[model samples]
Target: MSAVIRLLLRRLGISVIVLIGVSMLIFAIARVIPGDPARIALGPNAKAEQIASLRAQMHLDESLPVQYGHFLADLSRGDLGISLYTNRPVTKDIAQFLPATLELVFCAGIIMIMLGLPLGILAARYRGRWPDHLIRVLSLVTVSAPGFVWAVILMLLFAFYLPLFPIAGRLNDSFDIARVTGFLTIDTLLAGDFAAFTDALHHLVLPAIALSLSGIGQAARLTRANMVETYNKPYIEMAQAYGFFPSRIARIYAFKPSLIPSLTIIGLDFAAMLGNAFLVEAVFAWPGLSRYGVAVILRKDLNAIMGTVLIIAITFLIVNIIVDLLIAFLNPRIRHSARGSA
Candidate 1:
């Protein structure tokens, strides 16, 4: 077995364990909550008989063990049960809104990587200089602020005052592209609508930037610290002694090693955006899973909440697994050791 194969198997085992643990925890939390899903679904005015019927329908009247067994059975068949609030299949509700959240998260990640890595490199290359101090201060300030704060500030300045980007939503109402993918950028391009594509990018820009701000700061700070430490390593000193070009050494040698640590932090931030998207999406009126989560939670919609939490947990696990793989690839020790017979 190759090292890559071994690493992949190990990651798969970890992922399964995580999934089981998360499912159990979320299932327990959803069940133990005080509110009755049946009542919430039927509404405040529902009659006693109506509530009893709904409880039976939802299996809330079943023994706890039986209910859990039913849930697991449904899960095995890819059903997440019905939403108490919407009276729709939980899977269908997630299908409707999940793509938007994924799109937002994806755009935010791109913005973070594009801005963070380069800024970190620049800061490290000019350590102790005015530029380094400036980036450090800027990163600290931005990293300390939550994504919602940045979203509101951007809305007020760029949306209300300056009127640069549209205040909210995914795309302009005038564009006539089909919503096959639910991603306006892709849908517009597929329809050969360059005009609509440009409009979509314009809409995506502000929110993406807002989501990326803290991630960028985190990446830069992590990169700067790692690169600065790498800069003092004996290998770096030897490279300098060998008359290697400063720029070349920094870009090639130091950059790769520093990036390994940065990758971990970046992946964590990217995963966190799924949860953080709530306020940002709400403020922008972007219909995404996070908004759905908030609404479902407030309504005490058990099935909906379970579906949302499970999806988010799965996404987080996937992200961490990818990060682990990347780290293993970049770190020679792990890659080499993974293949050894045990």
Candidate 2:
């Protein structure tokens, strides 16, 4: 096999193992938490016989080992079981909710890359100057505060006071666009409703910015640090000695190498947004999986919780794998070494 193929296979195997471990851990943790899921599902007014029957039907009466075996068997068949909270298939609920979260995270990722990278490059290019000092201070301020704080602050300024954007929700109540992709922006565009698309984009701005602020700060700081170190490298010095323009040297010789390191942690930050976005989503009242996750957890809905966790884990792993492949592509040393071995 080619080196890239072998590397991908290795990552795939590792991802599978990590996912299995996470599944087992989440399953055990969910079960260990106090309260009977069946009782919670049925509510306080439910009769004893009803609770008992529901418990038996859910296999809650089975031994933990047997229950785990059943879970594995169901998983093999791509069954996530029925959600007690939603009274629908876990897969069905996930299908409904996951896309909203994905869309939010996607917009946040764009904000991170677009805002963070330029700030980093600028800061690095102007190290020890007033601009660098200003950027550093600004990044410090952003990194110190959490996402929810940013969400609330941004909402207050832009949504409540200025009222430039919608204060809450993914779309206005007026537009009734068809849900072709479950992503408001895409679906609106697909339907050729330019007006709805504009509204959706406006709604997305505050939440995506709130979700991305911390990531942007971290990415800028890391990129700045890495690029500063790169500046002292022999090639950079040679580029400077050869009388290349400072901008050219910074852009061509320094940025790419510095970016490789920054990309790994930035990728992690992007993936973590999937989880950290819950608070932002709650604040904005976005109808995403984070809201569903909160509902399931409060009720101790086992199947729903497990399915949500597994899907998030899968997303995290996929992001990591993509980062790894990108790193390998960017760094000639890894690529050449892999090719030699192949």
Candidate 3:
């Protein structure tokens, strides 16, 4: 087999192993936590027989190994079991909630790329100028503050004071656009509801920006550092000596090379938004999987918790795989070296 194919296969294998490990760890942790899922579901007022019956129905009475076996078997068949709190299939609950989180994360990722990359390139092009210093300071400030803090600050400034954007939620209650794909923006567009789409976009702005601030800072910093290093490279110097404009050199010669190194970390930052967005979601009262995740954990709903964790893990793995493939494609050295070895 070609080295690239072998490398991809290896990465796939590692992703599977990592997912399995995450599942096992989460399962073990959920079980070890000091609370009976059945009892929690039943509540303090429920009788012993009720709790016992629920336990029996849930197969919580089984031995840990047997329970784990059943869990794996059910997972193999795309069953995530029933949620104790929601009293619905875990997968169903995830389906209902996950899209909101995905929408928010996707928006934030766009903001990160749009704002971060250009700033980085600009900063690198300017080097030690005032604009570069200003970008560096702003990035530092954003990176130092937690996301929730930004959420609050942004909400106060834009939502409360100026009132430019809606303070909370995915959409205003008046808009009854049909849910085609569960993504409000796309669904609204598909429905030809430009008004609803505009409202949805307006509502998404603050929260997406809040959730993306840290990622933007990190992306900018990483991109700037890498591009600065690239500016010193022989090829960049050659391009400059050949009478190419500094702007052209920075945009073409320096930017693309620097981007390859920055892409992996940028991918990771985007994946991390799934977790870090919880506080932002809570602040905005955005109905997403992060809110559902918090509810299940608080209620000690084992199946829901496990399902949420597993989905997040799967997403992280998928992002990493995409990043790896992109890196392999962008960096010819990897492919050439692999071919040489083969």
Candidate 4:
């Protein structure tokens, strides 16, 4: 228990340090981008005096270190400055949009685990049989392309020709679901609108599938490869000799051991989905943070860009921490080893 607490504290402290690096890196990148943000925000007809004023307001005339000092000071107060794109505070803009992306990514992560693991297990169980071959081929095909390409393909097939799923958006406009959580499905459920919840889910399916396809494929391949290797180990051969059910051995003995390493890659893929969600969101018209981030970056909204990227960085670190805790939990030796080293 103490080891777990220590691990959490250590990870949190490391996350903070990483976030500071991320802030400085993003700040430098934003600063170096060609073109004055003030000119871009004000547009072509802006007077020189107006541009100077805006730059001053942005602290652009100050030295980089001093500008960064003020930026950090504002950040400490939870002030992300104003978004030139939305004319709102960046934090408010993120609050409005972040949950949608999180919901979408969460749904995709679920798909990856639920679908990928089983397929992998089945493939490993079958070895060189047709099921294994089929799954391998399918995974290869799915992973060959990026999420947005899948989004376009799936949208065209199901949304246009077959019309099984709606083409885009989080919910039908006819359903007046409250924006309680910014996650339409949860919000609708909270509102006791089963009909709206179903509609929201209906809208979520295509985009989630689009975002998850690559991850699903990657997970399936990794799980199958690892489990296959696990099967050849001495314990697996002993389990086979002991008359243990092949199914039981495969599920319990093989899968559990292989899962530790798989968890790290899977977690990374899950985090990667946040970045990948941008194109899929654009395709689906999903009004997520990804869309807002793209908008701010194009407009050179430095404050908004930094805020969005920082939020994403924090989310990424949080996911990694969760994966670490999960790994530590699953294998108690991690805790023991930490306590040992400490």
TM-score of each: 0.95, 0.97, 0.96, 0.97
Residues 1-342 of candidate 1: C-alpha lDDT, one tens digit per residue: 277687788888888888878877877887788988778778789999999988887788888778878888999999998887777999999988998888898999988888888889889989999989999999998899989899999999999999999999988898777878877788889999999999888888788788889999999999999999999999999999999988888887788888887898889999998878887898888888877899999888888888898898889989988998888888887778845655
**Cα-based RMSD of candidate 4:** 1.7
Ranking by lDDT: 4, 2, 3, 1
Kindly list the per-residue Cα lDDT of model 3 for residues 157-196, writing each as its tens digit: 9999999999999988998988778899998999998999
Cα error, candidate 2, residue 287 (Å): 0.8
Point out the worst 10-residue segment of candidate 4 by lDDT: 333-342
lDDT digits (tens) for residues 1-342 of candidate 2: 266677889999999999989989998999999999999999899999999999998899998889888899999999999999999999999999998899999999999999888898889999999989999999999999989899999999999999999999998899999988899999999999999999999999999999999999998899899999999999998998899999887776899999898899999999999998999999999999999999999999999999999999999999999999998888887777745544
Ranking, TM-score, top scorer first:
2, 4, 3, 1
Q: Candidate 4: what lDDT? A: 0.94
For each candidate in the order shown, give its overall lDDT on alpha carbons. Answer: 0.87, 0.93, 0.92, 0.94
Q: Worst ten-residue run, lDDT, model 3?
A: 333-342
Runs in model 3 lying further than 4 Å from the true structure: 1-4, 338-342
Alpha carbon lDDT at 335, candidate 4 = 66
lDDT for 256 (candidate 4): 89
